[model samples]
Target: MINWLQHAPVYPIVVPLIAGAAMLLLADKHRILRASISVLAALAQLAAAITLLALAAGAGDIWPKGVGVYLLGDWAAPFGIVLAVDRLSAVMLTLTAVLGVASLFYSLARWDRLGVHFHSLFQFLLMGLNGAFLTGDLFNLFVFFEILLAASYGLILHGSGVARVSAGLQYIAVNLVASFLLLISIALIYGVTGTLNLADLAVRAGTLGGTDRLLFEIGAAVLGVAFLVKAGAWPMNFWLVRGYSSASAPVAAIFSIMTKVGIYALLRIGSLLLPTGAPAAFSLEWMFVIGMATLIFGAIGLLATQQLDQLVSYCVIVSAGTLLTALGMPGVRLTGPALFYLVSSVLTTGAFFMLVELVERTQTFGANVLAVTLDLFDLDDPESPNRSDDVVGVAIPAAMAFLGLAFVSCALLVTGLPPLSGFVAKFSLLSAAVAEANASMQPADAWILVAGVLVAGLAGIIAFGRAGMRIFWGNDERTTPRLRVLEAGPVSILLLLCVALAAGAGPVSAYLDAAARSLDDPSLYIDAVLSASPTRAIGGH
Candidate 1:
């Protein structure tokens, strides 16, 4: 039992793997049992994640480096696969689990029935995400990336409509190219360093000759491009909106974290591979430029989009850009606040995605009515006194009112308005950026970032405001959408998480600061992973 407890880091990966395999063996007629198993596995994974987070943060004397290293098959570092859990990985694991729970709960309403093998695919996706976050080596990272991508392919095409199929094809094509690039980059790095372990690579990075270093930098640049495409960066994000908007609501909601996976890779690899003053330091500047461009583009897209689902999709791009911009800057001050913002933005965006499908149900009647009236002119109502009384106020239905309130909450959170976690996050991020600028004599880029953030917030507010007016206030003949407890419960839970994050900002900020500090200094992670003893068995087998 103690040995099993020592192997806490792998449970997040193992639980879902077993659950998915078990789900696959079950027939479609056993959906209820499959769903029960999936939810239980997800909950178990969440518990394991929280436990691992505690262990990584130094709950017990598990390791001295404030990192948990689990070596597979008792193999040592740079020789075998390993799972490393630091504060950053722990946070990501917890976030993934939270989103997984919410998405799975929402799916129970109707989404799971829309397609076959949904439970199995959902579990596999969780396994892939958890594995990606926990893996300590680049090789295993690629393997996990493939796992998630494969699972995502199935999820993206689950419902199988013409639009979904078209988007899935585009998404698959783009990601295949990305996967090829990833392989080339990995091969180049391996050729130069002769090792795929991140810690070993970091240790060997400083010893490369000029030519080898140049080759390595090229490889890293290619790898960054692969990650940026998934991150929904400008010029590389054309597939994101369509793919996400075409997905089922629960799938899209969970996919909100998928972009963050790219951001995580960028942050992890960037911090580990490119120390300050290294040859690859130039890449950070390019990252900043791309990030700013992505932010501006997303803002414009958000304003231009009419569909609520598409608007939420653009917001994901905007969040990615914000993270990339903050990460591109120097120091952990901005990075810390940016991490907090990541949590807030991901939660709110996910809730908004789920909310979109619910709200659209109410608008179908209004939409059909307008479609029929589009070709017919309303010439009879120009000067009639009876037309004045036709504008009688309609009382908002209880369900519509509830959805409107939820939409407003999501809007406030997404747009960074006051009294919400979004506001707190952006305020913290801008404050840190401002202080850094003042310290650095107020650089032009810093001020530009400040303006960009405010402008993006303004764009979100206007866009969501217009969407709300149209969906809730524009028509009095709207039907009250049937609100299911399972569906509404998940959205409320996610939104409540944002509120809770705001309420507990002080502690959460401190935690993120610690995580950021560890990220900024890779030495801690390197020493932790390299110094730990090899596992005595494969996950205590």
Candidate 2:
């Protein structure tokens, strides 16, 4: 047990990889076996992730320094086959696992049967996500990225509808281009520095001068562009909304974290290897510019969109932009709050994705068309009395009440309204911006950051309000949608978790502040990875 705990960082990648392959070998007819295997693997991964987070948080006896590295012993294995665990990776691992458990359980309700190998593909996807987070080298980073992207392709097109297929194809095309850019950037970095390891690159990158620095900076900029595309920054993220909105609900829910994959890479690589000043190739100012553009673009998209799914998807873009913009603000201690906002926004967007599907189940097709037509034509007279068949404060069925409340909860989360995690998160970010303005933060930049967040929240409120009125309060006669425990249970768990996050913001904020500080200074990670011997496991360090 001690030995296993000592090497726990490897379990997240290995367990899922083994389970996914094993399920693939089992004939497709054995749904029970597949589900059982997948569930156990996911559970094991979650447990391992929690343990690592414990270690990172200074919780367990196995590691005193809250860092661990697992290296492959096989003679044939490349030096790059290394897994490193620290506070940042641990947070992402736990988040991916949490999302995995919820989304997997939700899919088991019915979506798992929609396409072949769902259980296997789902497990494989988890493997990729975990691997991406745990790997210590840029080359392996690309490998794990491709693994996840491939799995996502199948998952996105799982339902096989025309809209889904078309969107998936475009998503694939855009990612393929991004992957090419990533490859080129990797090659450029390797050719110049002769090492793909992040720690080694961090050291060498800092020492480079003259033409070498120019090449490295250009490579980093290209790499940033690649990640920005994945992060769903404007102009490059045209594929995000269409693809995500068309996917199955569970798929979309899990995909809420997909954008963060790029964000994570940027945080890791940019802080470690890329220089951030104005003279450098990839400056923070550029990140802020792109982020604000993406934020404003998403805000407009929220108002322009009529569909619930699309509205939720635009919220994702807004969240990404908000994070990017926050990250760009190094003058302020906004990273901690930005991290808080990331967790809140990701969880809420995921819940929103799942809830939208259930609530839309109550909406009629003709009613939606009628509403759109009325809005476009202005057929109704202004100031005319409007009647709602849905009586105010009337008792609704348990299932419908669940949907309504869940919808409202999701709305609050999206809009950053009071008494929920979203409000707390946005408030924290705004406070950071305002509080730091008198210090290192430029007055104009702080104001823009605050404005950006407020505009996003306002847009969400308007969009969700319009959507809520149309779906829940529409005049068309509606019946309670059929509800399943598996379906509703996941939504409840996520919302409850959000509530808990708010309740426990003090502790959570402390932990995330630690993470932000660690990110602000990459030397801790550099020393931890470089000091470890490849032949032996590094623990308690």
Candidate 3:
């Protein structure tokens, strides 16, 4: 049992799964109890992640295949599902835990007001996220994705306002189509490869020739489409803005992590499931183009929107687009920066979403009083100084100013602005793209990276400008006060996280670089999987 505990990476997956269920059952009617358990569970997961990362970082040879593949109930690998915690999955699981804890903290005060089942749904959502990142089998990845989508369905529409419900339906509809296609893609891959274990599939894929290659590549493309859709890339991201705009702040904050999950899956499978001599050099380029397009589209949409939440939602789309564009660059080269940008974007965007909620509540005033005082600012009045009375509020002015700072920071990060980590990440990708071009002596790839950066930057500026104006300047009418400490505390903490990421980019960069290197060497992962004796079974890292 001790040997199994040491070899098995199952704790990462099991911790969340068990915590989620226990949170639901044990919370009872006391909101404080639920919040305490939820926060503790999330921290426990984070602690475990820190330990796992420390262990991996310390050892030269941590993973061994047989031991890493912990079969549930002591079943063998081929018949039973396995959880693979390669470097990529490990980083992502830790990310989920961090973001999950933040979101739960953000929701503590609002949980009771949100509805009876809000806490449960949120935990379940985390469960799905952790599981998806850790699963070794393709089929189980699909299952985890579905679980996430299902939990999001409830969380997204938790308040169930007319607009929220309508948008949630559209969001679910689009994903349903993509989900079906994803399952079909998996079935095709399983039929062709005769196995679903990612490591085994990677080894076996090399033996295929002719028709088999065609079938696999096509299957890969189909699966790629599903991930692209989830990532909110161009041509399929129309629903992202609407859904995010409608959901409550905490829901939207957590939902931002979902697109990153899609990006992670694409990278994980692209590295592990494809043959080394995989067909088509342009697929990555295609991903880059889609990201560029998303950046432009999101910017345009943000420029047109006046609402605080909607603007933030579109900005998220722009960030996701840029991240995906970076991923589409060729080679094992962009791995470090891509992961860096992804982590930064997730943290920054989550903070911005929370801030938007706070601003919206504080900026708007009571409708009843405003209606009574309408005559004072009536434009038709002969003696009126209406223009002078149009200020939004003191809190809003201060919040908007900070929000603008946040957006500029986001722009700097996303556009690879100088001295910021975003620039560091973009620099890495551009350099790789340039190297790939020089090796092939083709100027087109370099041109693609340049053009993509320009378009994404433009979009970031336009979107932030539009959103900033509405959040700071716009005042159509007044509404009831909704200020709550739980809400502000989370936003403040998230903003601190963003600041920490930017300020400590060097150490952060090293950790991500190490992660990328580990990802490139999958033998370590295989060893981890196979290290355990048969007596102990595992499911995920």
Candidate 4:
């Protein structure tokens, strides 16, 4: 047990795998049994993730043997892929676990109403997420992505609503193309490097030159397209708003994890394979261009949307774009802030969806309930006995007030407003870009980024103002019910988390700083994997 804990980087992945299998077995049994098992499993994984983070945070570098190659059956990486838990991967795994548990708990807070199948699909989704984060090989990443995507297909269309089904199909089509591209890109990379091990590829990628560089460039471009689509950049973003708007709140919460995987993969590849010094590697400039376009497009799209949920969805696209833009900045040391902003954005967006669910149940914001309430409040008829359902009129004002608060939080997080973690993150990235600009004597890109930041801020304010006015002060007299307990608890918890992140930005930034430093220098991971005792190296290396 001591040895396991000491060499415990792989436990995060194992816990979810075990939980998924166990949940699948118990799915046919009682709902309480399934919920208990799923929640316990998610929390257990969350605890393990916290432990891993704490360990990684304190330790100088956990992997010392070239990316902690944990060969599953004692085989070396060339023959068997290995799992590496460096700072970036560890932190990401921790985020996944935390988000998974939070989402699971939110779902359990209303299990029976959501259906039993939700639990099963959710468990599988968590498993896929854990695997995706921890996998050391590109092929396995694709496999896990498919598993997660298949589960999401079920989750997205779970209720069989017309809008959901229609939107889900579009989501499915987009991802299917992405999956195909992912496979083709991996094959080309393997053809070039003769290995799928990320670390090994890192070592091998340096040898390519001339036409080989062009080959690599083609593969990288294809791979980037696949990930960018998943990231909801520009032309590919329409499906995200449609699918997310129609999804259940819990489904939306789960969907929140998907794009993060894409962004994480982009970072992983950029850091590991496309070293800054490698001439064969493609530059990050294209990533920046796409990210900027996505930001502008999403902001405009949000301004055009009338529905509250759809507006938030487009904001998510904007955040993804910002991260991409940061990545594209030459010689920039902004990865830390990018990661921090991504985690924070996911937290707040998930919370917003929770709030949306509550508002949907209320009359003031309920597009559906508005119809129901309209018939009840038809003052033109005195014989109407619907006065009993006027519970909505009294609650509408309060619910809309809370909705206003949530909307502000969403804007702050998405647009990087002051006194918020979002702003801190954006500031860090821009500072890095400015420093790089000064060093390289190229000020135009820096100025463009600054302008983009200002425009984004203005767009966020205008969009939020429009949404708030329509949601809170609109003259619509539709009476609906009050915010339910199910909606209030998750939203409250998430709001507190956002507050905590904003207030304690110093410590959080420090942690991200360390993690960022670790990512830039991966020698620690290399040492850890190669330092394991022969007896404990389960897979032969």
TM-score of each model, paired residue for residue: 0.92, 0.91, 0.83, 0.87
Best by TM-score: 1
lDDT sort, best first: 1, 2, 4, 3
Error of 2 at 306 (Å): 1.3
Candidate 2 TM-score to native: 0.91
For candidate 1, lDDT tens digit of each residue in 1-541? 4667678989999999999999999986676799999999999999999998888778877755678888877788888888999989999999999999999999886667666789889988999899989999888888998988999999998764578899999999999998888889899889998999989888898888789988988888788888888788989999999999989889999899999998998888888866734445335788788899999999999899988989999999999989888888877779889999999999998999999888877877533532333223231345632122222223334877779889999999988998999999999999998888888864777777899999999999999999999888896767776667888889999999999999999999998999999987899988877876664533544
Off by over 4 Å in 2: 74-80, 274-281, 366-397, 535-541
- Top-lDDT structure, candidate number: 1
Q: In order, what is each prediction's RMSD in angstroms?
A: 7.8, 8.0, 7.5, 5.5
Worst 10 residues of 2 by lDDT: 384-393
lDDT of 3 by residue, 1-541 (tens): 2454454367766666776677667634465677676678778777766656655555435543211344666655655677766556667877777777788887664433345567667777887888888787789889989988998998887763577789999999999999998998888888888987776677767788789878877777788888888888888988999998788777888888898888888777776643365434225767777877886687677667766677778767877776777667665666787787777777767766776665555354423332333443352354544322222222333444554566566556544566565666666666766776777655675566657666666666666666556544665652334444455556666656656776887887777777777666666655554443455334433
C-alpha local distance difference test of each model: 0.86, 0.83, 0.68, 0.70
lDDT by residue (tens digit), candidate 2, 1-541: 2566767888998898999999989885577789889988989998999999988887755555666766656211234466778888998999899889888888776577667799888988899999989888999999999999999999998864577899999999999999999999999989888888888788777777889878887888788889899999988999999999989899999999999999988888777754433224356788888889999999999999989999999999999999999888764399889888998888888888888777776767634633443343332436422222221123335988899899999999988998999999999999998887767535788789899989988988999899888888884777566667778888899999899999999999998898888877777777777776654343323
Q: How accurate is candidate 2 locally (lDDT)?
A: 0.83
Backbone clash count for every predicted candidate, in the order shown: 0, 0, 21, 20
